[model samples]
Target: DAGVTQSPTHLIKTRGQQVTLRCSPKSGHDTVSWYQQALGQGPQFIFQYYEEEERQRGNFPDRFSGHQFPNYSSELNVNALLLGDSALYLCASSLGLADNEQFFGPGTRLTVL
Candidate 1:
């Protein structure tokens, strides 16, 4: 079975632009969560999606939003990006309701110029 997958692995953008990163959950999983890991910091939860609706959200601004598809894949979109938004965007997957160990993908490193 395929593990979680994220892309494009690396990204570069300007401070005012927008970016959309993608993720495919591990096989047999139905919940997807997005995390932001700043340099030298632990991953901070952005939001979680299950059943195609947002189930949980973190202490982030409205600029961070996400979507989940029926197939269990997901996408994270950041609008009007700021330099502070430059970080490693990680996607984690869990089966059914959360609480189990989450499986993470190699994150997408975003750099805002």
Candidate 2:
């Protein structure tokens, strides 16, 4: 089975521009979560999607939004990017069960220039 995967491995953007990153969850999973990891900080949850709906969210601004498709793949869209938004965007997948363990993919390194 294919594990989680992300696109573009790396990205460069200017302040005020927008970027969209994509992710494909592991097979048989129904939940996808987006996380932002700063240079020296742990991953911070942005939001989670399950059943084509946002099931949980974090304290991030409205600029961060996401969507999950029927196949459980997802896309993260950030608007009005700021310098602070430059970080590693990680996509994680998990089954919607109580003992689910999230599996991460190689993140997309977003650079806000």
Evaluate all candidate structures by whole-model CA lDDT and list the values in order.
Answer: 0.96, 0.93
lDDT tens digits, residue span 1-113, model 1: 99999999999999999999999999989999999999999999999999999999999999999999999899999999999999999999999764689999999999999
Which 10 residues in a row give candidate 2 its minimum summed lDDT? 92-101
Cα error of candidate 2 at position 10, Å? 0.3
Off by over 4 Å in 1: none
Question: In model 2, which runs have C-alpha deviations exceeding 4 angstroms?
Answer: none
- Give a tens-digit lDDT track for model 2, residues 12-58: 99999999999999888889999999999999999999989998899
- Tell me which residue pairs clash in candidate 1: none
